[model samples]
Target: MAIQLVTDQLSNVLDDTLRSQLVGNFKEIEKALNDLDGAQARLNSDQDKINQDLKNIKDGNEIRDVNVQAIVNILTKYDVPIQIVNGKVVDTTKEGE
Candidate 1:
């Protein structure tokens, strides 16, 4: 039954080959997953920084609005002609007119 022995040997070899390929594929998948995790971490860090920057910008705009209102109030109290030209307050009052 040498043919039977040879058939068994062929089956064993095929099984070994399949196991090796599967192991290699699993290793590649693990590496890809690790790379994706690192990329996700970087993206999260970038998003946090962007969010902080946006918050700072919003805070700065609110402070600027408060200061602009204060300036308008002062100008109005002093009876100065306040003219807004191109988003800027221009004092149109002249001394000794």
Candidate 2:
């Protein structure tokens, strides 16, 4: 009878130890998951900002092209020869001619 009581106590202690270890491991896993989620959020935010910046750059380029075309038209109207070379406008009218 005494041995049976001792075995029961040992079994209960082992069960408690296993439960505690499992709880600790779960807590660690939860923390790691939370950290990963935070990192992903930050990455998403950065990507959005980069996309917006690219759009802004495209819009600015379009505006610049419209302005350049207007200038070219005005120059043509005045009989001032101009050429666009490598995205730059160059006046081709000779000063002496």
User: Could you say which candidate leads in TM-score?
Assistant: 2
- State the lDDT of candidate 2 residue by residue for 1-97, as single tens digits: 1111122233355587667666666777777779889999999999999999999999999999989989998888988799677889998877998
Candidate 1: regions farther than 4 A off: 1-14, 83-97
- Per-residue lDDT over 1-97 for candidate 1, one digit per residue giving the tens place of the 0 to 100 score: 1111122333355587667666666777777779889999999999999999999999999899779878887888888788556768887778887
List pairs with backbone clashes in candidate 1.
Answer: none
- Give the root-mean-square deviation of each candidate in angstroms: 10.7, 10.7
The TM-scores of all predictions, comma-separated, are: 0.70, 0.76
Q: Rate residue 60 of model 2 by lDDT.
A: 100
| lDDT score, candidate 1, position 45 | 100
Question: Total backbone clashes of model 1?
Answer: 0
Please give the distance, in angstroms, between residue 69's alpha carbon in candidate 1 and its true position after superposition: 0.9
The reply for model 2, stretches above 4 Å from the true place, is 1-14, 94-96
CA lDDT, candidate 1, residue 83? 56
